[model samples]
Target: MKRIVVLLAFALTSCSYFEKQVPNEQELLQKELKAINWNQVDEYPSIAECEKLTDATQRKQCFFEFLSSTIQQKLDTDTLSVLYPELDTIEVKITVNPDATLVFEPQFPQDSTAYDKKKIDSILRVRLTDLPKINPAIKRGIPVKTQFILPVIIRGE
Candidate 1:
């Protein structure tokens, strides 16, 4: 009986020696969050056509190309080129929201007095509203908001 009691006590005490410390939920979450890179996304925002692409770089290129082409087409229908004859290109800041909404803001140069900023902004807002459905970027399997600047060329012809 004494040997059995001693063995049981030793086993119980030794069990703790081999056991590892389990982190709490908050600590685990913090550690996981820290491991993630906030600036880079696992997947780029894409349209239905770009979804078929498997390569990350190709997919990103496809998305940007599609967006730029679509924006170019939309702006072509407007008189932005005619209104601002000297403005051959405009840098547009595109925001892809997690909810799949897109916002476009035209970035003008410091000497932007040659162009009507309000009218150009209104034209961009109106023209860009007809974009096709876009999937938000993915970070660790979860959709995330992303913003990038795209330079769109304007053809005066």
Candidate 2:
């Protein structure tokens, strides 16, 4: 019984020693363990940086320019199905009020689904304009609070 107790104590102590090599309070407090600054000091480039271009048309073009063609196609398909249904195109008019609130208009074909109008507008506002880089140009009216039309084809049928 004494030998067993000694063995168990030794095991517990060694286990702690090994665990001490892992992340503990000391490592967490050290400067070497600082959290990532994703913007300035990381390889993972932000979408805003990727989309930066000289003009609105070029900026829109940049949205399609991705390092991976597969991801681009996926984004295109997802965008089509999510933003357009029962229509081959969509016209988005985002008007910025003098008070800085946005007004969204999603114009669909006459035969399009009776999608929740406010919901559709909300989705565009949150997903497109609310992006960190997209807001400034939109607010400043560089692209201007105006109409933007893009084609969308229903996938697989």
Candidate 3:
């Protein structure tokens, strides 16, 4: 009986001694990346006007300043006669393509603006066409595309 009990214990212990596979270097790298925030980039894309700044924070600020100024400067407020007094805010999704072209996507509340989508697209395209090529953002030393949602206020005179 003691011999039978010892053999059963050995069999149970041996059956439980399975090995776990260790991940390879590439698999380990991918697993580490899954823990990171992809939204944050090492370097932001810049325009010609923001190229002078050397510090990372300053460069990012300058890029945003230049972008906002460009949008505000190019908007033809005189052509925007369909804005409601209370709801004058229009959200513009600005995407800087890898090749440096600008795309303006306007989002307005249904009751906010009287203008149709086609009219708004036309209005924004004209202003966005003048945007210069942008240096793409960098992630781990590789260039990546970036975008921003800008709120634009249009007031009627």
TM-score to true structure, per model? 0.87, 0.31, 0.71
Ranking by lDDT: 1, 3, 2
lDDT of each: 0.92, 0.46, 0.76
| Predicted structure with the largest TM-score when compared to the true one | 1
Best-fitting candidate, scored by lDDT: 1
- lDDT of candidate 2 over 1-157, digit per residue (tens): 9999999999988986676445766777675446543223212122465555656555545543431232224335344465555544445554433333445566766785667666756555554543233332332222323223333333433
- Write down the RMSD of candidate 3 (Cα, Å): 9.1
Give candidate 1's TM-score: 0.87
Query: If both were scored by TM-score, which would come out higher, candidate 1 or candidate 2?
Result: 1
Of the two candidates 2 and 3, the one with more favorable lDDT, higher being better, is 3
Q: Candidates ranked by TM-score, best first?
A: 1, 3, 2
- How many clashes does each candidate structure show, in the order listed? 0, 0, 0
Give the C-alpha lDDT of model 2.
Answer: 0.46
